[model samples]
Target: MTMTVRDLRPDVRADAEGFSDTRRLALPYMLSTPESVVHTLTHAHPDAHFGQLIAEEEGEIVGTAQISVAHDSPEPGQGSANIYVRPDRTRRGAGSLLLRTAEERLAALGVRKLFAWVLDEPDNRAFAERRGFRASRSAYFLRLDLAAGMLPPRQDPPAGVELRTGADFADDPRPMFELDAVTSSDEPSDIAVEFTDYEAWLEETWQHPLLNLGLTSVAVVDGRPAAFSAAYTDGGTRYATAMTGTAREFRGRGLAKLAKNDSLHRARAAGYTEAFTGNDTGNGPMIAINKWFGYEVCATEVRYVRELG
Candidate 1:
């Protein structure tokens, strides 16, 4: 069967569905849906130059790729192209074709450095290595059976601290944004990011379709948002932690754990049966916290970098 690569048509619902379906099948631990796919494409920052591509084989989608420039990063000429082929459709050249097309598009936009996330499987690593990509860092995908696992019992906040839902900041989310910015900057990653644009955060993060504000928990210290666990639900049984972190000044106080535990409990009460999250391999603190909540490592992915001349 002959395979061809093309850009995803945002106006076409089937295209979004196919892209989301392929992603979910390829990376089950991560959450993806038609609505979330479309939302990402439409709300992406203009400077990001984001584009989604699909590989089709005789009218059937066999692979997908999301390519974009790291516009928000202070460093220039850095971009990313993440490609995934259906497990059953491997060896058909769909993954290669999609990646080639993505690289060409990003290169045309003056991107000199390209980054990708490849599953830690031998074949996946080999495929990327053959394309001049070098492994940089790794991260693990974790899963928890919310319906069957034993979650740590919720604990009361210590004196001078209060627990609240993300929804509590609906009228004014600037504090949430501030806390997210500080916490995210501290996350371990090969590519450093700074969330400085409040308006962009409002459009891309706060207003995201998958974000479940009611299920998200925040730890407030003296009326200030200090730590939080942002929740994302698929409108079904799957729940995922989008981001969990504590402000630098409040790191040792266990506020992050407190917030995440509350959010997990809320997710269970709301009927989500499964929970998922990811942590960089070097982030031992977060990994330990997830293990305490009964989350087990389900899969691992290696970050790869390639320099284009």
Candidate 2:
């Protein structure tokens, strides 16, 4: 009958399950699993000071928070605490408790500026504003129904280009990582991040439970990875494009579109029913690519920032 906020215990299966359940219920557009939840918490960078919090109400986990510092960013003292509460369990004090605890923890770690993503709904926006957070940039969540076959027809790679899956580079994924780093840097984000540590990438990204390497398509130029479409599946009907980008030198060649189309076709063939992705509102190129593939905007979320002394 009382709601309490505490750290998530990955060792306890119920805790992981409940945390994942609450996340999926709160934000179905993104993929989340118990294994991914544990992996992220365990493998985060030391500088990140990552923490996962769960709000339990009489034995049910109804809210969750992902708290972490932007360690990879060139700047210091920037942190994030994204809190999500179950829609059916609204009006409870779970969000407030989680936010207070997360802010305190990050502040203790010397974080100065805090950011959070709030669903672009009246109640959610009010909650963030009430906490002294101001609305910032926004992103749109898009979805594609694979069963409908609305995806663009698969096309052959251009001359001297080869299409491959992320699994093809499993023996050595450094190439894929290199391509990812280059492309990720070009993405539109308030926090600038650099993927400089290969081992950390392997531990935190390449080994993530939801990443389906077999379905992640890559565009190779003369045997080098030039573009990629990263895929993450929920081990079920849902499939999502985590990131899709082309190297700077490979832009304007349509390499990203090639990789993503191949990946989506393969995913549909593999029986995935729903596909999801998100793009910042300012990212016109990526949004155009998603539209070309029949993806429609389903939901939106606005980033909110607050200063912490």
Candidate 3:
């Protein structure tokens, strides 16, 4: 069977299903649904010009790529293409074909540099480098078996600290957004991102399909949100911490850790068997916190960059 590549058609249900399926098989740690996929494509910032590309094997979708420009970044010409082939269907040149097409699009858009994330495996890394992509930053995907792992005992709210769910702030989530912006700025990453646009945050983040506001834990200090652990579930047993951080002034008090503990405990009580999250390899503080919670690195992914000539 001949392998072919083409743009994904969101108007067709099968295409969306195939695309979502390929992604789930390739990256189990992340969650994706057809609705969310379509939403992302249609509601994406105009400047992003995102492309949902799929690789077909005899008309059957076998691989997928999320190609988009870093439109919100202060600098231009930065684009990203995250490509993945189904775990069972490899070595058919799908990745190579997708990368070739994506690089062409980026170059045509005057993108001077391209970034891609390849799984941290011997074969995956070799493939990226073989295509002129040099390895850059890396992140660890951590997993916790909630059903069997012994979790920290949940405690009552400590003195002067109150616990609240993200839903409580539904009428006004600007505070949560403010806290997220502050913590995200301090996160380790190659691209410096600023989340200053509150309306954009509400549209893309607060309404995300996987966000489990009920399970999200926020630590309140004197009446203001000081720390939080955002939750995202796969509409099943898999639960992931989207982000966990403390306010700059509230650091060192262990409030972030406390919030995450509360979230995890509630997740386990809710019958989530698997929990997953990713942290930059250089984020020692977050790595230590995950270790303390008995999470282990299940996989890794490395960023690869290519200079567009």
Residues 42-127, candidate 2: write the lDDT tens digits: 99999899999999899889999999999999999999999999999988899999999999999999999999999999999999
Query: In model 1, where is the ten-residue run with the lowest total lDDT?
Result: 183-192
Q: Least accurate stretch of 10 residues (summed lDDT) in model 3?
A: 39-48
Evaluate model 1: give its lDDT. Answer: 0.94
Worst 10 residues of 2 by lDDT: 148-157
lDDT of each: 0.94, 0.94, 0.90
lDDT of 2: 0.94
lDDT of 1 at 128: 98
Taking the tens digit of each residue's C-alpha lDDT, what string does model 1 give over 1-309?
A: 889999889899999999999999999998999999999999999999999999999999989999999998889999999999989899899998998999889999999999999999999999999999999999999999999999999899999999999999999999999999988888998778999899999999999999999999999998999999999999899999999999999989899999999999989998999999999999999999999999999999999999987
What stretches of model 2 exceed 4 Å from their correct place? none
